[model samples]
Target: MVAWYDPGVLAKTGLKSLLSETIGRQADRRLLDAVARPQPLAFDYSEDGDGKAREELWLDYVSDLGDGWDSTYAVASAVMAPTLEVRDATGQVHHTEGGDVLVFGGDEVYPTASVEEYQARTVVPYEDALNDRRHRPHLFAVPGNHDWYDGLVSFTRLFCQGRRSRGWQTRQQRSYFALKLPHGWWLLGTDMQLESDLDASQVEFFRKVAAQMGSDDRVILCNAEPAWIKQQVKPHAGRGFLDNNIDFLEQRILGKRVSVFLAGDLHHYRRHENTEGRQKIVAGGGGAFLHPTHLPRVDTRPDGFVLKECFPSQKTSRELTWRNLLFPAINPWFAAFMGFVYALLGWGVAANLNEGAVSAPPLREVLSAALQSTGSLLVAAGTLLGAIAFADDRRGKAWQKVSGGVHGAAHLVVALLLTWGVSSVAAPLASELQWSLRRDFLSGLLLFGGGALVGPLVVGVYLLLSLNVFSCHPNEAFSSLAIPDWKNFLRLHFDKDGELTVYPVGLRRVPRRWQHGHSPEEPVWVPDPRDHRATPPALIEPPVVIGRSKAPPLTLGTGQLAPALVTQDEQPPAGPV
Candidate 1:
């Protein structure tokens, strides 16, 4: 599980941001750009071994990958398998092979980006899946926010070296590149870094790529973030801001030739399509912790693209949001930290405990004592402010401020009430015992236990209500759960006649049990066959076809129409060929 809410991870993320900002100030990294490497005019894979224009091409788009071993490896295993036969809703099986070109959309590693992290979380899993394949896929990637964490030094070194992993070849010189595919199609991947804006050098690089594109040529623009959906979430940020880099590239550089906009920062599958059949898709569910799909309620984009489909439908997402009620169980370390805080707050109150009357202290006296202690006051103030800052602004900025105030107030009120109640009860007993060591120990035990047990529950319930009732904290609520299911990726096929079809592949559950393979021919690790969670891949939706006047019959790499689409009158094939 990638504990996004974990304090250590959060601290590291903040530190990364600080360091990146410092680097940005000292030297404009993007301008210096892939520094010594010679920029390629364009990587043209439009031809076959005979130097003739190829009739077909297959590509894979995956992003937001590289989290835990179980989740990451599960997705990698499914993707790297020689072929997949996924059954759709209507029992139509969609059979497809690993892409000739595997493009990582963005955020290849999570929490933080580094050589070790990528090697362990990403490279190792992918390499282990298919070690000795004859025809290896070419891999290209654009840097996401996570990839930008180390100032992109690690990303540039690992990916831009033009080296090869066990089962894939790295082909891009810079963090971004353009691939000229067959049948008048082009794939352009951009590195947005953390700013979500392209540098002058990047803009010029794309302009050169655009210069090579014919007017009728269609393009698949890959970005690190989905600006269309993001406009709805943070209306004033990124591409939503008038004439941002994305708007410029779409409007000026690529123009109407950009038939498809693909991105994957949000860890889910969503497709927004215009009436003209242009598609904006987000398929970020490679291996990271699942993000809630029932958020921002973006039924439409400003560009007139209507939301067509979302994997783990909004209803399922809302249902999954309810799991935050188990936050204490999911994040026991955080819960224990909260317990320590409560213990400190309680100790502050108990330290004021003197030889008072044998009876319980009055409520006013308890409150007064707590208010006088600087430590208690600071803790209460910090809790109130931190809760306020933690609130998500999905509804609006004003609503966020109001909801946050109430949330923080609830915590402070609970603390005050608990302090009063505990002090009132314990004062009588401490006075009777008249032993400082025993009294101190009892107070410490009580406060720590109470905080540990009660504090996390309060937080969990607050998260549950905020998300279910108010549509807030979608990221926070779900990240705390660190769900490893609902992983997905896109496999696209461009057939002989130039028609393109996208098969959205998904897995309902990731296998938890694994064993090392004994032979060189076998994968490094295989899922335990007895694991109940081992399920076949399924089509997230019917194959989405593009650029054809009418829907064409789907075909496989063997150049035959797919055998998986059986009619009611005919029995399906025994298995995928």
Candidate 2:
């Protein structure tokens, strides 16, 4: 039901994106930090006496949510569920209760942020999931690009104030915040805004938190975007890498104390570990469309980070990319729009020919007329420019633009050919049948039908080819599929012996069918058991352990571990585990 290819959806988001890049960027909302009253808890975290008082803590991390009901709600219900019992691929079972702290990594709402969208797509389902519970988890979030579309107004209103988001207690006073976890571990979230540029206030806030951290105290850094992966996929044209802000904070402010770097903008589960056992994870599959895990086509990063685990698998992601070939079937509304455009192109061509002439127009004239007409030229130019703009310009503007131009030309040629075929067929039929009155009308009708059938197919094939062959349009490629599976989030636990464990939780397929619950305590919408795709959550890989081991992790062969383990998100102590 959530079609990214829909023309209306495209136009609306496109306009908002334009506004965000131009007007929203000019007048940065984060500059209004003076408005927050500046809560003490926002910075200070020295009360715990260096992890001696507390024994353990749990926390949950999810990001890039708020799309359709089924997928988003499925994840929301799972995260808010009192307990989640998941198993690894080898059938090792693990169980975890809900966290005392819930961290939204970024992109809490999709398709342009608004209060209405946040309520409908994010709040309603989350509230319905756990509203009846007496104890509530504290919520913290960093803003992603989608959240920045409206200058973070909606995000600030909903999250910055210490209000309740129905079931969860909102605790952050600014867009970014730091929390002190048990056992000398800390969580720090950064708001890199639109340009990946941090404000002075944000830097000062983290610097204060860093000063309190002892030499052995570990930190978990949560960012909206996964700069490690983006550095390879879409690096800045001038700069070789894209993580300057993170590098500065990690080295200069945090003093390289960050043991884990977590993010969710990539929309899939991927974990990379360096030689020191430090983890970099991208677990963004929190309800929006799934992104490919097979991207960047590399097993390791230049910084010595090796790709250790990924959900949906790289092979599965490659196979999924092929689904875009059925574009018209996948997104019929977009196909209809393409059909309308072809019909208009046909009309423009016919208008150039003499209305009274009975003879069929030559194919050459049909093609020439398509080239000469002003409306037709506009259509051609629009297709080329739109495709070029959609291209991932970070891949080098000149080559990306040329590839996009070729993609647009494919669509243009197909439209022109379809127009000629319709005219050739319709003209002969009209002359033979002596149906003089409806000749032009019949041609117009044929053009619409043919274009509807073929236009979308062209675009789909273009996306498929561009992605798999050239490594382009990674966002556009998978978003067209709107895959509901491969949903994932992180559950982190800090244990008594000053060790941190990360569990990557994933769902193979979200339930499509739902039923309304009659009970007051239950979620309003529950996953219907009758749905074939309904299945239990599973662990994407072995639980990653940090702080105890400086060497690279050992491969834990598939086996049943006695103690069932999972992850959580929280700050300080809300309740005993």
Candidate 3:
């Protein structure tokens, strides 16, 4: 059961609360203190350093994970909008509520991360949750691709600066610092250093950090991208600051000291135990649109991952699973059904074009005329149905409503006119050009065009008729009847209120009613009302009541009926007996 709320509102409120509590109070004190002491100048480090130096430094920082966590310490990472929360082995809440460190994953803003993007994406609901937490955890972040879309200068300047001053340590804000936790837990911050390259010095720094770790302790590496996994699949891709340093650490310095690799970029949660026997967790579903999932194939191993649990926060946890959810490409059943229909229509057209065919001009003309008339009716009905379905009731957004109506009407007119024109003109042209092209080509083209145009109308009419039939006499038995040939026969139907109704094929006569409240054990016979060729009854009787005498039988019909069931207006209702 996921908790739902307006994410924008939630984020705004949260950020306001956090600013008021943490930075706001600090700023107030600084302002008062400023009267007595002068404020320091803020520095912009962008121009002072060369690109290569900066890149090397970034790599060095990521490769090294200092000695494992101290017995009393836990390293907290704040991942941006991680839809899923982290739980310890004992099921203790480690994220969402509060954590030791905050890791800001990339895409802080969806689609693209810009200044406005931050206001729209990151600042809202996340800020609210951050403010509500009792613990004020230290924050560190790696730049996600979206964060870097505009470059890392903005992100670094905002988080690294302290007291609005510049310098490596002083200029950097307190919000983006590495902390040595109580139990020897060392947390490092890398602010979207994906583009930079790592140097030998940085690799040495990582080695020093790894050397300090013990068997009982573990080092946790954090980043926006899963470089290790990406490298495994695509080694040719260049290593960034973090990747270069990680390569050095994995090959030279750290043998097995590093245990956990945490990342959030793919937009889907995944946990893979790499060949090195380390847990790689990707917690990306942080209120962002879901990513396609990858299904397990013969070439892919199960890899020991399975969905373990889902939390009320819409957070799902899996046991070492590597899954990718893929979006549906095409529905094969729909294609196959349409193909069969076209084949049948093509055969009919081919037979009609036979040179030795019997002379039956009257029958041919009548059939063509009937088809044209039927096509017109279908187009008109479809357009009206589409218009009704597309109508919106929510008021006040006048432009949206008007545009929607215009779109619906346009589609309706196009469908109707197209159908009528095509049916009327198609046969005559085919007859005239019968000698110009091969019989198969002309027949195939006509069938394909007609099927494409009529598919929706057929589906719509079938659905409407089916609903009318079903509503006429509702019963449990009717519910059990499987809609026959629904794929082939039924047309999609839309009601005035934009509700969809589907009528399956071969769903004609109602089956015998079973015992009261008891469903039939076997399948029942029902015709699909979508088969346009079939005719249904003009009028149907309304539903009837059938209940035990002791329970009090009730009758159902139009308007008011069964006065006993209705609440009395003149007198207060009696207390329950």
Model 1 — which ten-residue stretch has the worst lDDT?
Answer: 554-563
Q: Sort every candidate by TM-score, greatest first.
A: 1, 2, 3
RMSD of 2: 8.7
> How good is model 2 by TM-score?
0.89
lDDT of 2 by residue, 1-577 (tens): 3689899999998888888889766776776763544745343332344634667777899999998787888888888877888887798888777887899999998888999999999888789877564357788988999998887889988998888867788877788888887666788998986577566556666767777766677788998988767667776532213324455566545644778999988889998888877888999988999998777644688878899988889899989999988888989888888888888766778755636656767879888887789888887888789778766675687977898788788878888888777766676677787875766877777778788879888888888887788887778889999998889998887777878878888888989999987776677788887897687678889778786533222222121211112114312133221
Put down candidate 1 lDDT per residue, 92-173, tens digits, no spaces.
8778987889999999898888999999899999999876643578999988988888988888888888888896899888
- Candidate 1 has a TM-score of 0.90
For candidate 2, give the lDDT of residue 150: 85
Compared with the true structure, all predictions reach lDDT values of 0.79, 0.78, 0.33
TM-scores for every predicted model: 0.90, 0.89, 0.36
Best by TM-score: 1
Clashes of 2: 9
Model 3, residue 553: C-alpha shift (Å): 83
